[model samples]
Target chain A: MPKKEVLLEINHLKAYFPVKRKSMKEEKKVVKAVDDISLEIYRGETLGIVGESGSGKSTFGRTILKLVEPTEGEILYKGQQIQHLKGSNLQKYRNQMQMIFQDPFASLNPRMRIGAIIEEPMALQLTLTKEQRKKRVKELLQKVGLAEDAMHKYLHEFSGGQRQRIGIARALAINPEFIIADEPVSALDVSVQSQVLNLLMDLQDEFQLTYLFISHDLSVVKHISDRVAVLYLGRIVEIGTKKELYANPLHPYTQALLSAIPVVNFDEPKQAIPLQGELPSPMNPPVGCVFHTRCPFVMGKCHQVRPTMQEMNEHQRVACFLYDK
Target chain B: MEPINTQQVLLEVSNLKIQFQLKNGKQAKVVDDVSFSIHKGETVALVGESGSGKSITSLAIMRLLPIPPGEITAGTIHFNGNNLLDYKNKEMSHIRGNDISMVFQEPMTSLDPVFTIGNQLMESIRRHRKVSKKEAREKAIHLLQEVGIANADKMIAEYPHQLSGGMRQRVMIAIAMANNPQLLIADEPTTALDVTVQAQILNLMMKMKKEHRSAILFITHDMSVVAETADRVMVMYAGQIVEEAPVRELFLNPQHPYTTALLKTMPSLDTDVERLPSIPGIVPPAYALPDGCRFAPRCQFAMEQCQTLQPEVLTVNEAHKVRCHLFSGKEERAYAEEGSLT
Candidate 1:
């Protein structure tokens, strides 16, 4: 077997946003949105990032894209450091990377026509003629399974599913090699969600595009991802190939999260390990292991010392005291 | 239909028709001829996507639909043998919190942002029971504790915005279960919540129902939640129930094309499939519904007759019913004869 090409590499990336002080006497604080995360994305594989809300999954994605400036660490695309790239250099990186937002209605401009919305990205990045851009827009519309007439209409006229298709069209406008879809199908209906997921998979094969799909829905992530990462309070708890991680999740948080999902299949016996309390405030996260407060099988060491990601096998890695030995 | 024990029935809605007035003086029938009954302490899930009229049906039951723009055109909503449609506004208000309470999807918007959590909980309690403010406040703290909020006393003083989404939803549930209403109507209550939090809330709701012996009208678009919580399920599409069955039977052998398609389309955690078998086309708009079966346009087994004639509900068994042309008496006979010939 040949070695797979690494499309992107992130190293100890940290993104923090300072919180406003309530009063003069109050101490300064910051939200540790993405804290010391490192990962690799293969050339043509979907890497799913799953976490609860406020777990900083979205922040991690944004930090990698440089949409939100990282406070520390490196973001390397195609083995080149691009985190500090600015202006035209960053603009050039934008052509190779694009993001699809969660809410289609909010992401697409309400005032602009559908054709213009798809063409806007290309116009900013590429030196294509207006006529060529318009032709490409039509082709993209057809590619996403939308009719040509959709290009003439506004955002509000289309259904949620159609609008999401339009969002995908716009993301592919500049022929980006990588796309970060942040909960792209969460807003869509069940039937339509499958359609979009299928389209994404088809497009990946067609263009050899790598995806960083971030979502709270575990089932969706499991369906489309080649590898999966479980995040807890802005830190990765577990990361491995989809089959290895899902079938034999080493992290306690991952086990709880996998069990928490209310599976539609009734034949399987359910043993849900209920996590105690809500996610602790990101502003003031828990001491030591971020998950120690809620982990069902937490040991004393889990409360005093933070666990680093350790390899369980060739493919699976977990950040937990249970796997430390 | 199976023999339904009238004594055990908590809420019965029959041939319910709801319409919304459009700007062009036309009325759009949002909910068309919907009917179902919930037994005491049994959860009946009304499952559908947006514009499928699941929310509208629940809202109509609460008598919460706006008067001018939205109105119930026909049908009777019988709560414990009482027709809620005929009740006066004052009488309906009395029944709302006292007997049938609703939990909305958006907990933040449903709760009063300006008021403290204790203030809102006590208001619901005081509205139904003739309790003093002091007693109500104590009960509010107790209710908060019951919903799994650890620091009830501290939480009571906090504003809605101060609480997390999960905490706010728990507070909402506490308020809903304040009066121990005989029936609880939850409209996608956990849709906005995270899966872990959703599991917690769902557990709380189930526990509350068991303790109070209240029937739940659980409405959501998620099939997994329905499989988890519902005792019986009703799959709605384009404002009509396309299938109704016991929870186990619905999952095991769904007869309706829509239900079958929905179950297949949903990405399952237990199994791996190359590509999901998705249903083609979008749900038809309510104002311009097709003449024949509503799902015909998207149905894989749709016949020529299905395009022109609507199909009535066909009972597959004592606990299962499906509304599809493939199950109609004529089509059944035709298929039976063809099978014999083959």
Candidate 2:
């Protein structure tokens, strides 16, 4: 195997939102959407973040792309802290990190032609002429499995799968090193979903692009990710290689989440490990272990002292009292 | 558990055909000659991807299709041994919530925000049954508690906005089972929910359905959900029932090319594969569907006859039927390759 390069590193990243209350006199409340998370993204691998709604997985991805300003901590791009850069320095960093949103219908401007949508990013990032950009757009359309004529049509003229293809083409327009795909395939049908997933995988291989693939669907994330991370209530519960995590998940929350995914094969039916209660609000997240409220194997200590990420092995890291040494 | 009377069919839809009027004075068939029956206490899942007309078929059963634009051109929906098509609007309204109820995909939108959960549940009970406000309220709380809401007593007075997605869906299920209806139509009830929450809701639905012995028409595109909850599964494509079989049999030995493609395309949680065997093309639009098999364009085993000749439902076994030319005359065991057939 060849030596891998560290493309991006996040340390103690926190993204908080000010909560609005009815009474204006009340002290402001903050929703810690992403709280004290650290991870490393290699140059050419897909890091999947799986969680339920309001799990802060999306916030983490947005923070990585610098879409949401991090309340604290450092985001190192190629060993340079780029979290709070401004002016042309920020623009240069932004070009290297692009985002593919969840909804294709809303992500692509309906009024603009498909060609213009794909070229907009290139125009902003690259110093190419208009003619060169148009040529590159045609090449991108073909690479994502669309026809050259698709450039002239509006976004609504295409189906869900085709629209997603256009989104991929746009993401590749700037030739970024890392792409944050936030629930990219969740809005698509199952058949179309496979197509888009395959397309993303192929494009990753061809472009040697690193990805922060965020999705709530575990099956999809497992299918595409080299490493998987489980997020619960704005905290990373477990992170490991796909094989290590899927075969021997350590965190109680990870175990429950993996078992809860309904298996398709009937010969091997899964008895779901049911989790109690819904995900607690991020505005007032549970103290100590964020998942203590619903953790099946929770202890009294979990309600009082938060467990930090403990390295279990070379490839697996888990945040749980059960793994405490 | 009470022994279910399998002989008694709660709802029977035969040769159901539906079409929608296009803006250009043209009519497009959305569902054609679709037929199935649900026995008492049986859960029959109508499984298909989008544009398969599964939702439209469910809407037709509820008689909720917008007229002029949408119309049921043929077939009868027999509920409790009576043809529902014969019921007038007034009679249908009486039967809608009392004998039959529906739970939609998005519970937040399905539930009214202004009304309290208690108000909505009690209103349905009082409208269908002769009961006082006090009696209705008691029944409402009982239903909520049965659905596993911890603070049902205090939660009933709160509006739908106060509850989470999972709780809202549970309340929807509570309302659907309030009358102990003979039939329940769950149209992708868990599609909008998270995986963990989906499992919880599905477990609750199965438990309530067993206690009531109500037949369920579970409409969803997720094959995994169908495997977990359904007794029988019907695969629909291009507005037609391409295959129908017992749940285990369908997963173990899928017959139709479309069904095989679907089962193969699903990313299995138990196993990991480098790449899934995706079906080649999209489902053709309604107006431009093939003259014969709708899936022929995407079918890997498609032959010349498949493009122009319509295939009839061929019985492979007592509990399995498929609509594909390859299996039309071959022995069922000949094609069972244990996932290596493709």
Candidate 3:
């Protein structure tokens, strides 16, 4: 096989938000939303980021998109460091990258018509005339399976599924190369969810789009992602090809997360390794191994020392002592 | 598990119709001709999408539906052989917390933020039982511990906001199980929690139910959860029960076109498919429902007869039932042929 092109890369990315202290005597604390994460996104493959709430999945996506300024580290887009880019340089990068939010109900502007909503991104980035932009908007609407006349209606006039299609159309307005969809279909019904997922996959092929699909749903992530990353408290615990990761997860966190998913099968008995307690607060994550507090296979070394990412196989990498040896 | 006594029926709802009066002087039939019965110690799942009337049906059984806009337009709800619909407000109030309890989806909103966990738990215990405050507090602590909350004593003093999402759900389960109600109505209880937390909560709920041998009206849209927790499954689409069968049977040989599409649509954990087979079009709004079958607009096998006439529930076997015109007559052969094609 030929070598796959790398579209984006990040090295030791960190995003920290300082918490408000109630008193002068209190020590200042920072919520380590995305802490020292490094990963590479291939040109047209979907890299899924799966984590529970507060696991910093959303923050990681935002930091990569430059929506949230990273506190530290480098972001390389197509072999060029774009993290520190400013003004027109940064604006140029934004045109090639777009985002589709989780909640369609809240993401789109209720006051604006569907056409205006889809065309807003183009108006900002593309140098197109009014007629040209209008034609493109209608074309994009039809591409997402929405009617051309749908542009005349407001956001409220559409159903949840239709609103999501509009969201997709808006994201595709500028023909982005990389799209970060944060739980795009989590809000839709099971029936409608498939429709959106199919449309996304179809669009990705047509546009040669690289997707950073972030969702808590393992089933969804498994369906669309070529490669998957498991995030635990702002850190990537495991990264591997979908088949390798799902079939043989090495990290304890990754294994627990995978087994916890309720399968729709009755022939096989459920083997959910129930983790004790909730995800710890990011403001004060555990020392050393962040997942040690709830890990089923915690060792003395795991409590005192953090494990760095180690390659387990050509397609799989894990950050756990179990695989380090 | 002890064998469920089929003779011991805990709750039976027959031809239950619920309507919401729209602002435009129109009434939308949110739940129409829905009928089912829950046997003692059995978990009957009510599965549906957002507007499929699953939640509304559960709320109606609890007698929690609002009055001005919402009303039980027709049918009857009988609990423990007594007609709950005929009971007065005050009389129904007695049965609310003691006989039948509910665990809502959003733990953060369902819990009172101002009140401490102990205060809330004891309030339910005290309301249903004749107990002293100190005794109620002890029982509350025990209930919390029963739901797998460590340091229950300390947890009781904490407010709802002080607890995490998973912890708050544990507290919610404790309150719901305080009285050991014969029938427990959990409406998407674990939907708000994380997958790990969801697994924990599901195990806890099953454990509690086993101890009490209570009937559960488990309501959720998640197919995996339905497969894991429910004993029997009822698939609802647009205010009607389209299919009913045992959990395994429902999953293996779903009869209704809607049920078949729903099962195929969900991305399964055990199997990998090239692309999910999705149903086209959206569920019709309740107010503007189609003339005949509710699912006809989206059903691929929708016959001309299905558009003009509504299909009644047909018994496929003793364990399975389906509501579709395809199973009516000669079309049954067509249904089987189409089924093999998929």
Candidate 4:
């Protein structure tokens, strides 16, 4: 919760993908996918990001890793700003930070053997010898619940769940203190999801790692995160400790999103405050509070102006006209 | 069948078995010993993961299974009193998309791109009912308006590609309801759309169900959709009905471990837990399924005997039935805490 203890601080992160016109002569249209969002990942803590498909949760994760370059923003990693840091400096930052992608099948190269996939990062970035990297790869395989013989197999040889484990092993190969896991379990089957989750948790404990876990699956995020940030159309609508946010959500968008999630309990019917309208295109986002159009509690001020995140009830921050008072 | 107030039994599919001719020259039984009935004005959600044979079961009812690879090996799909499987192509023309219509997962691909919405709508109406082209166009516009498509007549003139994904799905629903089918088979109707768009489709379906007196056979992998619309639920696993009960009863008191695990895997929007609870192991390949219990290898409560002997569907209560050794009391051994298959 303290800024001093923050391992990664993302300040005003912006990612805009250029839309190329039919003619090469025409100027490209910039789509502001991730628009000026700021958040911090603390030491040994999981900061959860929840949003619908195009809410820029993935873009936020990718932006931090420099997989997709941020148009603007300062990515401060351990007190030093990593954004715009190029060549050797960027390479160094990548070594300190690593990511586990959503689709493990696509992330892991099919032609590469599991051992090579895991060792590839170490080979390029680290000063470790061949024997050392191999030894490290074996250790990572064991850590993620894969057998030593699994190393010799190609990426396609394993199931969805197993391929995800290989991905975890590869992410850990760089020995990063900070990891960005982007919907790591979404592509997996329900049964296999828990195994990979448990493995990640175990690895976190052993390594004392901090995680920026971005997922639309809130329940999964709640199981592992210390704090959570709720995103709506490229902006943080609500953020607080898991208990505070879930127990008392302030933003209308957060409330609606939460209501959509179906709990297993059937004894009590959920008061679903269903959201209004569809998600606006990021290419042309609405003015004022991005969620104001859908918010049931919208006020005159909500339409006219954006609501800054106001601090409420010990560490909770919410952006909404209802909370403006 | 329960006592019908306004709800009538529209679609009654009994003892359905579908088989596909395998490349190995063997017949692979996909839909085996499946039976469920839907009321004329109720939503019966068929829920399962991939390869649970739900899609195939829906296809079999429509008599739409591809012949060479897929054949309705056995069973009867009785809509009203007529067995649909026995109906000739000419006879089925009266029912397919007229009496019983289907909505697939991807609406974009399913909808004819080259054909204008006007032609598609008019064709369906003319096939079943003897109506003038003008009357059919008017009916098509009316149907489109009912499904909440904006400026119906203008939109009908445009092709499916001209419409957004959400609007395209609305057209699919309009086509499905053009003749007011007694049974609607929606196989992952909202799966392809984003959450916001998915919500709209769901709302539209729920709205349409209210306006039209028809049974909805909603098939989806998402448990949330089931919780939203289903009056009753039929949970399938490995081509078997693991459990079947009233919607509320099934959720509150799930007798099967599979059902419980499924419930756990779904992350509640309200419960801000750190990690999602999940079951371990993937669905066994169809060819490699255990002779005794298909779910035995992945089941946490699996016992030594479960590997060799199939458990019968034993009634836990009047409202619940489960196919597991734990419920059957055939295997008394507790699930070892640390040795969970996951």
* TM-score, every prediction: 0.97, 0.98, 0.98, 0.90
What does candidate 1's lDDT look like per residue over A1-325, in tens digits?
3689999999999999999998979998999999999999998999999999999999999998789999999999999999999998998887898899999899889999999999999898668999999999999999999999889999999999999999999999999999999999999999999999999999999998999999999999999999999998899999999999999988999999999989875776698899888899899998899999898988999888989999899999999888666
Clashing pairs in 1: none
Tens-digit lDDT track for model 4 on A269-309? 76777766567788777788787677787777777798887
Candidate with the greatest TM-score versus the true structure: 3
TM-score of chain A of 2: 0.97
- Worst 10-residue lDDT window, candidate 3 chain B: B333-342
Against the native complex, each candidate's DockQ, computed on alpha carbons, is 0.83, 0.74, 0.87, 0.39
What candidate 1 gets wrong by more than 4 Å, as runs, is A265-268, B1-7, B333-342
Give candidate 1's iRMS in Å, 1 decimal. 1.0
lDDT of 2 by residue, B122-167 (tens): 9999989999999999999999999999888899999999999999
Taking the tens digit of each residue's C-alpha lDDT, what string does model 4 give over B57-146?
Answer: 988888788987887766788888778888899998778988899999888898888999889989988988999999999999999999
lDDT over C-alpha atoms for residue B31 of model 2 = 93
lDDT of 1 at B300: 74
Report the C-alpha lDDT of model 3 over B186-254, residue by residue, as the tens digit. 999999889999999999999999987788999999999999999999999999999999999999888
* Candidate 2, residue B264: how far the Cα is off, in Å: 0.9
As a whole number from 0 to 100, the lDDT of residue B188 in candidate 2 is: 98
- Candidate models: Cα lDDT each: 0.92, 0.90, 0.92, 0.82
Going through the candidates in order, what is chain B's TM-score? 0.95, 0.96, 0.97, 0.92
Ranking by DockQ: 3, 1, 2, 4
